[model samples]
Target: MTSIVTIARLGAQADGIADAPGGQIFVPFTLPGERVNVAVSGKKADIVALLDPSPLRVTPPCRHFGDCGGCSIQHLEQQAYRDWKRQNLIDALRARGIEIEVDALVECPPHSRRRAALTARKTEKGLLLGFNAALSHRIVDLEECPVMLPSIVEQLDMLRGLGLLVAQTKEPFRMAVTQSASGLDVATDDSGALEGPARQAAVEYCIANGIARLSVDGEIIVEPKKPVIMIDGVAVIPPPGAFLQAVENAEHVMAKLVVEHLRKAKRVADLFSGIGTFALRLARQSEVHAAEGDAPALAALDRGFRYGDGLKRVTIEKRDLFRRPLTYKELDLKFDGLVFDPPRAGAEDQARQIARSTVQRVAAVSCNPITLARDLSILIEGGYVLKRVVPVDQFLWSSHLETVALLEKPKKRR
Candidate 1:
């Protein structure tokens, strides 16, 4: 039965929050302050039919709206979406007892920055080729994706063809597409666990269709392997499946911020320094020790540093910061600064250790703001003062917020 409901507020997932007679219901595709007749679907009532739409709800730029799971806020105007993201970050931090003045949200140029993406496998009907449907495992056939870089969008047809071939073979596959200024890289997985003959066929199709630089199961199958992307005019070849920041331009901004923050210090320790993005750049101005858990990424960073001229000031260390905290004896030499970029979980033990360390300045880059706020509180309670919190909107149209914070130890009392 279809029910008429009034949306109350916006939820974290960009769904409209509405109060039902039973309880609070989240309706997708319905904006706040809108009265709509919706048919419920699944456990949490989804808006099946919108009898009335909100004025704030505008036509999404992408034709794949309401289907593609990648973007939820496309129905909102661009400026409004940006404003909402900024407020979401502020509110999230406030809920954690941290106050932030989000005066200027760093804007990301649409369709300009994404470097790596994973597309979904196509079904037997040969329609969907991008991402799974919203809140469902069924793939949504995509004709176009507005958020992707222009180059990637152009290759959609080829990708669809590959997906169809894979589907016919009854093999599951995951396609990793990475693009840079130099060219595109298409990686296929034919391991039978994911995608088998279909993946192999995809690579063959790419080669036959003039797609260069392909990798299957982390090994290059075609073209001499090289970094297809350059950062600040410096070519950086990331290790296979190594963690590179998915957004290209945002990475540049993040690296610049971290490097600028570390420039004032004489010695710095970069934790979780994937491919030495921050460590290498900061080494130009100061000595840096790049510590990472992944050996392959660390090896690639070391190799890159060997050929680079400006980053001679950097050193490399392979350590899992999560498994064990850095002890005083381990860091016998006091560092002037510490730059850490941990995964989504944030650096809890590492942050605690830094709070106790002799480092005067700390720069923390986090992919999750909630964890960032919690970790920041720990540092604050540990005698460190929060100077500034800069929020970077790396993942647009999504609730995810990336932030960089600068912290300093309090001056000792006389």
Candidate 2:
């Protein structure tokens, strides 16, 4: 049995760090300054008993708090969790000797997640449906997830039952459920392995149960038949697996921040533009070139562009920026500013290319702070100055943090 110890600090993986006799031990579900009896589960340890709980440790809001992998810090006070994420970003940048004001943490409401990919498994007990347990392949059984929107949580039992039926077929499958402004979508595994009657059964079951759209193997078979979400009475239909920011209201907030930063620009290039979320919105005030690698996403953008007035001013291009970054010469037509919403692996070569570009202003949106810091270091070394860094709590309660930054070219020194 491992000796109980006092957790001194919080680690990167949302675990508590304790000083052991020989070295340091990382313990999960134990907060800083908390003395807990731990059971060494594997290479790491788990909290078995809390001898002295930290003042900051509060009862988790969710019933499935420890079991569901969607959130790690639900036990931490809501306000403290926000502060920790803000400090995390600040510390990450400071490690690179970069300095900037981290704006107030934008808090996401509890149970506001609109998109999730839950795993399902057939066990002796029944069908298990939920996120994979932290650092384990075991699927956590969840009656209802607190972090998901109520509409989604309401359908938990139905989803589990469906999963059980699918599992009984002895076929492997995964589900991607998304809640849009209009209705809901349920997508099943589309590896092209399941076909004939079984495939038909899944589709029929979803349609009969009121699933708006059904995708098999990444292809949208059932058109989104639900009523569109109206913004100012304008109906909008987001594409399947399109990069919609997960938080319910954070998308609008992030768009506002980006627009405020790029207000004066006449022309802007939006890289990794998914379904023109920011690009189309930005086009209302400036010309935009929406560059993305995925053909289906671009096609969806093209369709949206045809109908929306704001998108009419935006141009679409399908290019894999990772394989071949846009060079200064390639971007012969100079723009006043640039915006990029890159994936988790933050833009490396693209950031360098932006540094070399003639554009005077740049707005970057990043999901991972470590990669964001690394990319920022490259841009700073190449003579770009970070003006502001805003930490957005898009994925609240989760370890993930999203940030948007404003950068400008520094004056050349003699």
TM-score of each: 0.89, 0.92
What would the per-residue lDDT of candidate 2 be over residues 1-414, giving only the tens digit for each residue?
667888988876688888887688888787888999988754478878899988888988777778777788887876777778888898889988888889989888878888888877766676767888886767777777766788888987877765654553443356777886656776666324445676567667777777787666666666537524333223456556555678757877787888888888888888898877787778778888888998777776666666775443778889999887777655537577788889999889898887776677788899998889988898788777889898888887877988988888855568
Give the Cα lDDT of each candidate.
Answer: 0.73, 0.76
Steric clash pairs (candidate 1): 128-141, 172-194, 172-195, 173-195
Candidate 2 Cα deviation (angstroms), residue 161: 4.0
Q: Name model 1 segments beyond 4 Å from true.
A: 41-43, 122-128, 161-171, 190-212, 328-332
Give the number of the best model, judged by lDDT: 2
User: How close to the true structure is residue 143 of candidate 1, measured as C-alpha lDDT?
Assistant: 72
Residue pairs with colliding backbones in model 2 are 190-217
The positional error of residue 181 in candidate 2, measured at the CA in angstroms, is: 2.8
